[model samples]
Target: MDDDDDLTLNLFTPAIKKNVGKSLENVIWGNRQQRIKARKLLKLTARAKPTKTPTLSESQSDVYTEKSEIANNKKRKIADVSLDFDNNKRRNDGSGNVSSTPTKKLKDSLHFSSLFNSNPEIPTIDVKPVECIKEEVFSSDSFESLSLDTYMLRNLRETMKFNQMTHVQEQAIPPILNGSDALVKSQTGSGKTLAYAIPIIHALQAVRPKICRGDGVFAIVILPTRELALQSYEVFRALVKPYQWIVPGCTIGGEKRKAEKARVRKGINVLLGTPGRLADHVIHTKSLHLFKLRYLIIDEADRLFEMGFEKDVKLIIDCIKEKTLKKQTVLLSATLTNGVERLAGMSLESPVRIDVSQDETTCAVTPKIDLHINTRDNSNECSAFSVPDKLKQLFVVTPCKLRLVSLVALIADKCVLAFKKSKMIVFLSTQDSVEFLHKLFSNLFKENDSVSCMNALLSDQQQDIRKSKCLVTFYKLHGNMDQKDRTLTFTKFSTCKNGILLCTDIAARGLHLNNIQWIVQYTTPGDAKEYIHRVGRTARAGAQGNSLLFLMPSETEYVKTLSNMKINMKEIMMRNVLHNLLLLFEKLPKILENDRRPPRTYEEAATTLQIYIEKVVNDEPEMQEVAKKAFQSFVRCYSTYPKHLKSIFHIKYLHLGHLAKSFGLRDAPGGFSAGKNPIQSKKKHFYKQHPCLEIHNPKEYVKKPLSSFYEFASGH
Candidate 1:
């Protein structure tokens, strides 16, 4: 061996191996030894300590600290571990010390490490992280933390996980809990239910078994519509379960009166119902005591006034009045019009008012509806003509029934389906027209296409069938079917697809249907306002859509005036209109004339009609010019028409009443009455002298009083 090689090998061999082994030991086992020694010392300290009179300070009691609690927890663990260590150490001590304390045989009743093990898998005692959860600090937090005693937590998680607390709820809950009355102005879906419900439940809990008999209820909710009442009832029922025995009941129209009374007879802590129904129960029933009613909530306040239920709502409030029964009233509304706000002011006393108009976090802000105006070609006259496509020819030569059939067939033919097919909504002039068109359209689609119908007259069973079987829902929704149902039906229609929603003016203003691509005015609207609403159905939610207006030849004047309004539409001439007119007139000669005035021989009639047609066709320039002048006269005349007359005469029939009759005009039923009373009719001289009796507002036409949280139940 070479001396240099041997020296190099000796330097690197055992020294490198020993250093490498020492590092591996330190990396893996160094911390473990320290932990074991700490455990032993902790055990010894615990054994030497006395447990009988441990000291506590003023600060320790005043505020619970995380450190103190943790130290207290470790004390127990140390005592157990210390006992084990002390026994072992004493046996090994060199001094043969005989202790006065007799040593009991140590049985492994519990493992020290098991009791103190941080790892749960090591069979250690399970100690919840109670200290980690911060104690409820504020009064509101303490109140919220109070478990919904009988109510399940799962429901809260379900409802709130998807829908966050709305603006009204966030603002109202605290004040209500603090026993303050509040007035909320928020749109639909603004969480008004929870706003009143949470505080109501809390108040009920505060005044539990002591609830006075005639002291009726802690809360009573009133709604403008039955559906809203029922919905509110369900929410209260879910929330009131936490109050254990307190039950809530609802009374509304279309339910058995006896059954409703029976439910109320069982002692209701909360009552939800429409004003009329609630009034009926209170007025006739012996059980309910308005004297004790503490909380009164009027929901949909604006709608109540709109529905002309202001009187009924006030009567119910008056009936609930009592002295010494100090109550809080909360009124909720989306839009508080003049009359509605007046009513609120009358009812609630200086209630804290909360209006969440600009809160985007809760309310849904709709996209703008684009307005497009179309000017026609070669037409100096402007009026309703902008929407001429929606109007049909005046003086239907064919029977009205057959014309309706043909119209549906035409719409069916023109409908084209693509991946995202747009739907058509036909605005009918009357319920009869809706029924006739719906049947015809349904038959046509049943054979080759898909269609549905919506109107007011169908039975509930029929409505359900249409809603489920047909993609198109046919329902006859009107202002009469109660407010709640109306809101719900419209909400549903707003979402459905490829739907032909045949609605009246009820679906026009303030209601939105997003996906409509074509709006066909089955007949011209009654007025400019009506016309705007009908056309507004199209181009909703920032989408492009078309409006087609059906017009009569004589309605040129009314169309011209509307045309001046800058609406966008085009003339869609039905090419086969002449042929269809001939077919119609061929059978309607007797009806058109109203009497058997003349029956021309067929051969002679055909020849005469041909000559007339030729003259009409040849004089197109003169005819068009005359049509323009007549239209101008109609606009001037209609502009000055009395409000009463304008309300009765549809804008399309401006100066063409006879033409409208020949074309099957449908008049609204509310305003005009052609027939006079026998006594009034007999006095012909009085009528002539009085110049037509003007409808007058009475001197006692008292404005409705509003309800406020400040004056509720107290002033009355």
Candidate 2:
């Protein structure tokens, strides 16, 4: 053959054609060969024997035996010292022993140990047995018997419709009317506001010359939150309707500063405000004349300190004291703490201690049946903190994965399926959880064609249909909401006949809502004391109410902790809740139309409900994002438990994957390193070396003035 013909034959041959496409295969094959070679190197190093035998001392033998035992028991492979890069340098001695560096040894030790080796030990709370105080009977004395002004009595009876005096009012009013500084301690919803309000109104009205709008402020009421302040202001306004000369005004953080300043300039007879705003007015508003301030009332005294308002309260008190010498300071709280006493010492002088909760007449009226007999060491404080006589406390032990489903089931059982109207408050741990759950449930229970069809199927009568259609309105309130939004939510939820309020601890304090049938602690409070206040929201003013607490298996021990503190509660199985929920769903097929087949068991019900929720979350990216943020915030909040509760609520014991499921997430998000405290995560530090390069105005980065850049670079 010719030379050119031989070349063409070689190119067209099957072997040559196969070789043409082998370049890509060769690269992949080379990677596999390198991986195999690396594995072999590791095996060789693991099995490598020392060149020379070194005599082992007795201590060294003991250490080796202990390490071997640990390896065997833990089923962990001991790190091979020969595989370490530093082993060769350490083995340069005549003795051919491989020694690991300190860091390597530490790493191996940590690898063999549990991730949370430093978990705190469970703390034992020393709960003192408190003597039960007898319940005080309501006084038969009417508003007329209190020696209040005629106009005030008419307003109370006709306008406010407050005729009968509660035990607190009977005890606290007489002392304050006698012009003595008073410190009153009573359980919530016991007419404490009226007890102080009536006396202050009477004192203001009895002034020789009638008080007018131009008289400036006379009575100052300071509460912990803007909502509470607004509530008190409304009460004052209603009571002063008959006595038109006594004008009532309110100033809070979220309102228009110009309006508040104008009101102060025009002169307010009675002022109701939160500490921060009150103090701000005292400092800035020149027209706010406290010289004639006759009464200074601090409601929710313990809460003021708990909310870090000590400085503001002190500033207001100092300003008031400097302005007036005849001021009567009154402090009222549900539970009297040392903080209250300290506040009294600083603000009140020779105050009359009026504790109607401990009064014999009060205790004799109601037998000590539902008293929470947990007392602190303070002798001056009430011996026992009492819940309402009619409040029914219940708790449910549920797994983390079923928390959200169980909560939905419980709410449905109480609000929708029940015969009577219901009002509920579901308290979560973080604001993010409250916000996310509020939006999620609102969507779930929104009025739709399906809901309309289900309502028709459930009820044949028009009235019943109307009731069912209007039932289960959802509202959310948290600290992060705007002031106007918070006030609007409070008003809407208060007026709602059958509704659920999803909130954080912000609602657990001094706000009162009429006919709240149930209080659901979706997440237990970090402090045990907060449990009392949370349940206190319902069963106010001698009304019947119920409360439910949701707990995980890891948190069941909290029941015992609460029991030790004299908080009575009963546990309900999670299966029964799921079963009840399934029954409810059987009637309303439209709610769960994806599952045509009826759930035969509670397990099936739980699975179906979880699947529905997860599908909803997965279909909406916004919901998924919210779920992630809520889950992360919940973990951070859980990690911030009080030191005494660290053992029971240890974040290490939390199943993040299962907890994520409750938030409608399929798997836990990453970035949570083991043994790292989420609450105390390290913050990013910014260096000032390149000040000019740091983008101060992100929107106008390119338009930054050169002069400003030069000044910043020169450290001006």
Candidate 3:
């Protein structure tokens, strides 16, 4: 029954009240959507109550009006946030002009004094528009033209012997010297190191007194690989050595952490190191400080981001500046990827992008990378473009088993007979191949009497640079070997006038070994970029060279992909493709027919694919999320084949496919589901009900101490 009706009936009679209360059960609220939880019945007083009116003071009226204005300002501030979002979206999209009229009145009325006077906890943040790059830039020619200091010019002319400037150097140096963030893209070995190094040297000289051999680093240059970091450190050392006080340091993997920490703590003015090792010191050890850091140069920037060092890089960037410090960031790379662009957006503030490595002018992938993909499908699709004019490409198509023999005969015809005491580097895809080929060549030299590749350099003018003249025909190098062994092999290879160095991709970068007449590819590399670096090892510094790729018949399909990208290779036969050298095919050993496809078990195929995926993960951590996409892309071409392309690849049961499921790529089979990730709630632990731990002490710890040590000792 309704309470109001029951009260009305109670004022009448008991008999009538029961009937009225039962009838009131059908009564409804004002609206269906709105329901009252409690209803009260009003009663008519017998006598009228006295009425009173109260008046407020003048101060009370003023305070009430002030509170009203603050509430209105809060409403206005909210409107500004939305307006800014819309304006930023339009600006980013390049849709059209944005009218600042929407925010003009609110910004004009903005008064920090009013907001802060009412509430002290509220903060004031200045909203800044997105910064954009300048339209034009200037370039410098010689050291004299750059307006560098006297000492720097002296070093440039006398010590470095640098007379003329390269295109990238002339253009990139001026802006960087002016303390503006810069993004530079140029080809490998295009004097990119010197371009950045000159400006860094100039800046360090200006801040020389402040730079000491203790406390924190002033400048940091991050690289992708350990070898590159070490190489960069060498360049930095040369520049810093002339100036005694300006010390430079390096921290990379494969070093003692305790030593690195001590070095960083002692102080370094300019630092060069790998991202992973640098990140460890800054974050975990807390030894390396970037407090006074003014310059940050990210060399090989594209690879650094691709190798999934973004998180670590950003963490280090955050530690550089607290509020007012402005860090000048410089990014350099051969090819600018989308990741590099995104990195610019995040870190670089209105950076000047100086791109000198245009395809027509610079040829970043110069003497272009020779690519050859051998898909099972016969359908050929490719990009049509001409190869680099200077590069001479030759090929030897052979079965799986005959490759070793073909290499021997080709070397005999090309290097020994035609060009005596010529330098060559054979790039194999794996260490195993390098080891196997080194042995195969040795055996064939003994077996064949007419042709000899051994001890051919004994009579040559250039003796082995090493103390011992072993008279070996070739030296082997790969990552599996110790650092000491690798360095020895590289030194021997670089100095030798006529010898072969069989190695993998470890020799592909930073180590400039000129006078390399030929590059023999044992197999196609993993990708187009890899192909460039591999072939790029040769034809360097404007030198004319030849690259011969040894491919299986099916692998020739990769040519179309390369051709599409303007990397057209001229196919030459095994019989003296270099018109100068005559073929020694007749004297070569008889070849035995072997299986056309690679012989691998299901487990072997899966394991190999897994290893490749792991390598990719080191460069791309986000791939772990979309692993299923990667798997589907690989397996799509092989799905239709009946024997699964001669059992070389086990597509359905790939190890990558199994690993993908763990990274939220798919649901487990048989109705198994992944557990929900634990998410902490936003409700903060407030001290409204709970007493503070500091204030509330336990009774046990409140006990009094003994009067003296002697009494305690006696009691015990």
Candidate 4:
């Protein structure tokens, strides 16, 4: 080597040169000796030990210094390596000792957690209902005590069977009747509709000249959804039956614009409509006059803003204000929100804030009819949010694979074979999920002789088992459906004696269905406030109701989060849900019995039902497509949860394969094709850009004659 190369080589330890060109055995031995020497040097450096040095010649001292410098450089490099090793050990195991086994790091890899417990004895904790310290406002006054016209009073007592006033009605009606702009906040199902509706009718009745069809618009009531508009229209229709001269007309988005224009030309005494449709009339329909408008009532005001109807509402308000400045405005909401406050500021003038939910004043009215039996303080009294007092809230922690069977069992046990007529609303996260489950359950509960045929093939002992003849009627409602279909579905579900309505969040707010017995959240809502609105559908008007929430083991943290929001729920074991399902199957042989042997155990029964559902999906190509779409939509919805709830509903922790099983798919869609990962697909973008627009034939878009307008309008 050159002298320069030799100088570079001296910088490293001499152990490197000694190991080079040696036998393999010698090299290994050399490395061991080098490590020993490094360790000894470390000890000497750390201890700073004094070394005896005898007097030597000048050349001898120079060579010794060079050798000592090389030794120090080697010791520093070895010390760095040792310190790194110790740091890694502590980082891996959180201790000085190294871990026995190396942990396999998984980055974006699939794995499943073992959450299913075979033990049948699952413990449950009972949640006690929290009582509010505020005094309850129990109004015993009847409707007669209010200064209402005789015909209105008669309609209230005899026609509507509403003899007594609810606490909200007792407090809100008086202020609204006094012609003061009012902001009202009460619990859901607290007679809020009638609170404003009655006052509007009463004021119109006192007009000197009796109102007629061509009297122009007297009052305009804006609602958040078309279904709510229709519902309010019905209430107005029923209330105005005594005064036939006072006409009530509805103009929502689904109906024909020409027909609504004609109604406006002829004149509507009371108009009820959704914000968008009403705003369209204000802009386009010249005959729709607000010159004589006396009242403007916005029901579900918070929902109005939440649904992105703020601009439409403001447009209608500005137009109404231009027409008349002396009108009374009533803003009503089940919950008070900042958006509602902003809306009130824009519309209401010196508004009387009558919040029966928080008001503690006692009414000095005489007791005529005791209506306390029909009312309870279950609204917002127990918590910051309000739910029906009579609602029995329950939650079940289930494994992803067992989610489908658990829901099936729960519905069969609670709705199908129950002694009384049952009405249930099953809320899903996505529209595709609602559509797929509706089809699956409809086929499973078809009114046919398949169950009887299977029972006939059984032994006489098994044949003797009694069967439930009650048929299950399934209805679906989602935003994607045509307005007419949605309206018809809502109407049919409302009137059906025993039925199940599979729906998305579109039906979560403001539509009051009669006698809703159960609310089943098949998918946990992304927002906690949504849970409050969903469960509020039941236990309405002092009637007893139940709600069941399906949750995975990973989502148990949601229960605690809800508890902090003052929403109490009792835990129901998965074992008990399965047991109830088995009992129902035993009673009703028609469900999932297709000439097959009976299940002997709960596990077997669950497996059989799962296989049966999977067959139903796979056997039909259309259903298989629906299943895939639903699965993809569900995952997309799950991943887009709000930031605060990301910890509880993380997409990384979800088992895609097991989640697909709940949708009746043998494997997840992403696993089926390497090139097409459904989770990362562009379908979500397509839906977002064209939410209400669907691809169809060119002929369908062409305008039709007036005769075929109904078919076109209904999307038939």
TM-score of 1: 0.43
Residues 252-271, model 4: lDDT tens digits? 88788898899889879898
User: Candidate 1 on 143-176: residue-level lDDT in tens?
Assistant: 2343333333344555423223445566667666
- Per-candidate local distance difference test: 0.46, 0.68, 0.51, 0.69
- Model 4: how far is 627 from its true place, Å? 0.7
* Candidate 2 residue runs with Cα over 4 Å from true position: 1-134, 360-383, 447-471, 586-596, 672-716
lDDT of 4 at 306: 58
Selected candidate, larger lDDT, 1 vs 2:
2
TM-score comparison, 3 vs 4, better candidate: 4
Model 4 residue 280 lDDT score: 94
Best by lDDT: 4
Worst 10 contiguous positions by lDDT, candidate 4: 707-716
Which residue window of length 10 is worst by lDDT in model 1? 707-716
lDDT for each residue of candidate 3 in 1-716, tens digit (9 for 90 to 100): 45444333232433322322342334323332111211211111111111121432345534533454455456555654233221232222122323122223432432111100111121122222222211111234676887787877777678767666766788788888988888887655556777788788788777735566774777888877665676677777776656778888888765777888888778788888877777777777666666678788888775655455766677666666552287888888766655566665556776777776442222121121122221222112211212223556665654432343346545765566554556788986555456655644543333223223555554544333322232237888776665456657766777777778887666665556648888888755534454555676666545677888875544555554454445646665533432221233223221111211221332222222222223333335454333333233223222222231333222232222122222223222222122221112121221111121121233421331211100000000
Residue 345 displacement (Å), model 1: 2.4
Clashing residue pairs in candidate 3, if any? 214-266, 214-267, 306-619, 307-619, 372-558, 373-558, 383-563, 383-564, 384-564
